[model samples]
Each structure stands twice: as structure tokens, then as C-alpha cells.
Target: MYPRLFTAAAFCLIAVASSKAEEDSHAIFRRAEAPKEVRAAVTCDEADDIITRDAFAGGWLWQSKCPSNHANFIKAQIFSRDKNGKDAKLIRFPVPRGTPLEEISNVEFFPATREFNSLFVNPEDESVCRTEARWIAQNALKPKLVFWRETKDCDGKKGWRVLKGRK
Candidate 1:
């Protein structure tokens, strides 16, 4: 009887931990609940979520989901300061049409390198394709495209290509 009780307690503890882990993994902001600047900068009619908002070089970087024409899409915008350190016009990037939101949703920032990175996996078959991209934010408002690599045949031995800058 004591052993059974111990096992039940342990299971309950594990369940609680698993629930917390999932909750912590996805920290998102609904469009309306986002900051005023974020709402103003976002042009979509209704955005489902704001996945990332990080301080970049001299400004901020934003990534959000905007659904339009029955299609879910992701958008990116950067804001930098002007000569007097006031907010300047937002710079919008046309995230390639049809690019899966999963590709850019979880943006990772590296303070030391001042770079943002993203990983992409084929939704249909995760093991068959993968892509990674990195962007460097400098003194200017524009984030420079650093590298974009993809492996169509995620096999351990093939299909690695550098589509843009160095990897």
C-alpha cells in the first residue's frame, strides 16, 4: 500500500512539472494585448500572436503572425532610433511568401554576436528537410542577412547548401 501511494504521488508531481514546462515553452502575446508601438507597427487586420520582441542594435526587433485571405502568415519589422535617439520609421521585411511560421517563430538572439537565428523543419517530414538562418543587426535599422543553409535530404551525409552569406 505504501509503495502504491508513493508511485501515485510521484506521478502527480511529474504531471505538474510537464504542464509547467509546456506553458513556459510558449510565451506569446495576442495582437491586441501587445504594446502600443507593436500594434501600430503591425499592419495586419488581426494578428494571432506576437512570438518575439527583442531589443536589437539601437532599437527593437519584432516577429508576429498575421492571418490574411484565409492564409496564416508571419511578419518581421525592425525599429531604430533617429539622430536624436527618437524612434524612426519601422523597417518591414517581406518574409518570403509561403515560408512556414515554424521557420521563424522561435527567434534566438545572441547578445555577444548581435545576431538573430532561426531554424526550419519540414512540417510534412521533419527528418527529410531542415533549414537554418542567421541575421546580424548592426548600428543601422536594417538587419543584414548573414547566412541561410538548408538540407533537403536531412540524411547525415548530404544536401547542405549555403543559399546566402557564409554559415
Candidate 2:
């Protein structure tokens, strides 16, 4: 009977330790800073608007305007080029409250020359696809080209696979 009791206690302790480890891992990932290139492309006003208005009551955040039905829950960070040819941001949109950092597939930005590139990826598929965006002078649909990508666990481990994107 005493041996059984000891085994049960050991199992409980192990469970608690595992849970704590998972939480710590997530915290580390969440604290990662956005790349400098991406940061430079965003504007302060854009970042402020994203944090203030677009963040949902539950903390889920995404880009405000969806140009098409395919665009939904689209969150992004913008980086632009400085006069020195380095990336600088006018603003930065942070990750929304409830979204896990690991679930983020990609962080994309339009470079100084108006070309877009992915700054980060979890699984690192290493494929680049080019899509075009055309501007409409007065239309609400500004015809902006958006960046899209999917995130997967690097080692096929236990983690969420998400379709992360930005414009």
C-alpha cells in the first residue's frame, strides 16, 4: 500500500513539473523581439491604431481592413527603409492577447523599395511566393498586396499549426 501511495505522489509531481515547463517555453517564445528590418517599416500612428482599436475584447488582434473575404484576422508588422537604406518602422502592431507566439507562421513587411519579404518563420519552409498589389486612387479597396504564410512545428512536435499573415 505504501509503494502505491509513493507512485501516485511521484506521478502528481511529474505532471506539475511538465506543466510549468510548457509555460516557461511559451514565455520565452513570446518575449522574442521583432526583427529590426520589420520594425523600421511600420509607422507609430499605425502601431498605435492597431493596439488601441483593432485589439478585440479578449485580446485577439489582427489588421483592421480586410480587402477581400480571404483576408480575415490578418495581423501584421510593417518596416520601411530609411534614407541610409536600412529598415526603419513608422509603427509596429504587436501580437494580440490570446494568440500564442508559436502559432505565428510568418512576420512579413514591405521593404524600402516597395517589395515584401518574410522576416521570420517557425518551421522554415523556405519558399518565397510573389503576389502583386495595385493601388486604386479613390476606392476604399486600396489594392494592397498582403503577405501570407503558414506555421508548423519545426520537429513535428506537439504544437499548433496556424495560418499567420500580414499586409
Candidate with the greatest lDDT versus the true structure:
1
Candidate 1 lDDT (Cα, 0 to 1): 0.54
* Cα lDDT of model 1 by residue, 37-59, tens digit: 65565555445555455545545
TM-score of 1: 0.51
Model 1 Cα RMSD, Å? Answer: 10.0
- What is candidate 2's lDDT per residue for 1-167, written digit by digit as tens? 99999999999999999988655322111111433343333322221222211111112112221121222223342222222214432222223234322111132322223332333332324332221222111211121223333334433333433333332
Which runs in model 2 stand beyond 4 Å of their true positions? 28-71, 77-167
lDDT of 1 at 139: 44
Off by over 4 Å in 1: 1-30, 43-52, 66-77, 80-103, 123-128, 154-157
TM-score of 2: 0.26
Q: Candidate 2 at 12: error in angstroms? A: 0.8
Native RMSD of candidate 2 (Å): 17.4
